[model samples]
Target: KKKVMADTNVFLDRLLNYDKENMKESTVEKMQPYIKDKNFRPEQVKQVSSALVGLCQWVIAIEKFYRVNKVVKPKKETLGIADAEFNAAMADLNVKKAELKAVDDRLALLQQTLDESNTKKQNLEDEFSNTEKKLTRATKLMAGLGGEKSRYTMQSESLGEVYSRILGDVVLSAGMIAYLGPFTSNYRQELTEGWQSLCKKDNIPGSERYVMANFMGDPVK
Candidate 1:
């Protein structure tokens, strides 16, 4: 109410001091009586009341315009602050998203490495298993062949003994073949016995109990 009264007084002072030269002539003439007198006569009481009502309406309209502007001005500033805060929040959110993506990428790399390591471990295990199986089979095969070793060893030793006597056997065989083919059985036997006796006397190898029939492979004897 006080503010309304102040605005009313200011409006009245402006009306009293209004420049008549700038105003229209008809408008100045119509307002000149009220502006000069500042007091309403009994006959002009209704007009004065009407003018006061118009002045109050104008004051109210002006006050409302100023009040609306006051409210809008601060709201505009608040809106600017709010827009800046929103932009900053969005920037923070984008940074967080980038960080999350980096973390996800790192996690994927680690998972891939772990998978590769697992594959290598599996391959090593398979190789070890296969090698172990081969070793087991080889051990079994060697064990199975163990029984023949002694017989082979004895055969080797017998062959070595036969090899040592080969020279003496060859000499006796050659002589018998050259001399015995043309003789009668009794003569051949007699000659072979004499040759055997001579060989034993000289301590020749394989001559101690030599048999002509056996050496010659003669089935008739």
Candidate 2:
């Protein structure tokens, strides 16, 4: 996810600037926060997150093993045990400790990198969210400022916009999911339509995927 932000930003820059040759979906993910924005596609973000999670788990395990190994010490030298036995334990523990120490160091570096990456990702998500809200509010506020175009009601707007209009909608949604469980029993078509209307063809599917929607019609929902 940390890499996701840098890579996605680079990709977006390239896309907006028309650097088409190297912009590859297989290599990146357009973070979920920007799924509704025409500037990015979420499939790229899903790919990167899935790949990085496996790598992160692998590195975390290596770190744990190293920490466990560091606590081990050579057997007592004064033991009446066989000379060969002492030699074997000393040799084995030394090599294992060294190898584990190296792994531990590597893990520490990776962890630092991951932390920095997460911070950047979080920043990007916040920016993406806030930008969406501002745009939505501006749109709605603009409509109300003029004539009765407000009659063109949407159950919702682009995620960026909808979130802006509904204060704490995202936070509330998180609460609903975490505390109340899945919002399966009661669903609204207008909600579905509003989301659909807001989403461009490229990004809609990605946002819909985060929630397991039992769609009524075309699977596109």
Candidate 3:
């Protein structure tokens, strides 16, 4: 825009110089029509010619000044119309610039809001993912603990059955020992022989035979 203004000023300067050069010659030619008297003395003619020349110069100067200042007359209404239209165009451009600035501001605000929303959404997604992972870990832990509990219950039931059998055997052996007198070694031997015969009938192993002997003697006592 500045370059255009500089170029326009240069052109106007050249045009004004051209017009000034032509104005003096054209003005003198136009004034010659009014000067029809050829009877004047040499001195008077020179003086009147000089005066007419001055008047012509003044007229050209006034015209140049009027052109330079862009004085609008009734005969040249186009100048006024052109000036009005240029002013209207400039006003419209200002309004358009203001509207464009407002739109830019609105866009900036919306973009900021969108960015904040995205950040919140990302945080929520991260939190949900973390919660999901924690829940999965807890589920696995519970499942593992349940397996351990089930195994313990089964083991306890098996142990309880074995203890019940051992307790019954001990009680039966205690009754037998109490019935058989301590002084009757012969009768105790006979009882051992009878238990051995019963073991053989039941198909008991020789390695387990001492278990019955220990139960009858040590456990009973």
Candidate 4:
């Protein structure tokens, strides 16, 4: 029991004094002496065996920790890269959305312009149709009045000729009335016809077929 106690105290002392940075190597170096010493007693062998088992367990635990960290570090780096990529993608999507909104606004403006133009075009077409209809009606009216216009022109020319001869005709009729009052009806008619023939030869204006009886005869007779 005393030897076991001594061995345990020596083991604890060695554990405390060993290099912490290279724990596995220092612990193995310290235990190597006991393993190779074949002259050790049963208790010493048992203690050494127990220490080796514990050392193996520590080494395994440390190795597992290192392996887990190695794998987790790369995974963390990959996750960071993926996060950055996701943020970039989201930013690009936002830009594209803004562009699409601008396009939609432009399209709406263009549509408004097109609608206004169409409305203007329709109004112009309607105005043209009305103008064409008015022109057609005017043309037809002019065509229908063609003969009446010609007749009015002839009447106007005849009145102008009569105006030129009005004074001469009035004097001749007055002279005949004063000179022929004492004559018989037959003599009056003959004299009036002769005067009318002479007036026509002189280009005087009067009735085309003049008769003295028709002008001065009484309605009661």
| Strongest candidate by lDDT | 4
Cα TM-score per model: 0.53, 0.29, 0.44, 0.47
Candidate 1, residues 10-72, lDDT tens digits: the string is 867875574533444465456546545535333355466865656544434444455475668
How many Å off is the CA of 135 in candidate 3?
0.9
Q: Per-residue CA lDDT of candidate 3, range 1-221, in tens?
A: 45743686685565456554334546556645544335333445457686445444544455555555454444357767888998999999999999999999999999999999999999999999999999999999999999999999999997676564564455435545677566576776577556656655665433223244654456656
**What range of 10 consecutive residues in model 2 has the weakest lDDT sum?**
208-217
Best candidate (score: TM-score): 1
Off by over 4 Å in 3: 1-32, 35-53, 59-79, 152-221
lDDT, candidates in the order shown: 0.70, 0.53, 0.64, 0.71
User: Which pairs of residues have clashing backbones in candidate 3?
Assistant: none
TM-score of 3: 0.44
Candidate 3 local Cα displacement, residue 74, angstroms = 8.8
Residue 116 alpha-carbon offset, candidate 3, angstroms: 0.9
lDDT of 4 by residue, 1-221 (tens): 55744787786676456444333545545655654566443454457686455545544444445557566868888999999999999999999999999999999999999999999999999999999999999999998889879998999998787667665456567867789889997887788778777888887777665544444457779
For residues 1-221, write the lDDT of model 2, one tens digit per residue.
Answer: 56745686685564356433333443224322343344333344445576445334433443444445444323323344567787899999999999999999999999999999999999999999999999999999887765544444343344446444333334334444565453454553344434444443424332333233321225864
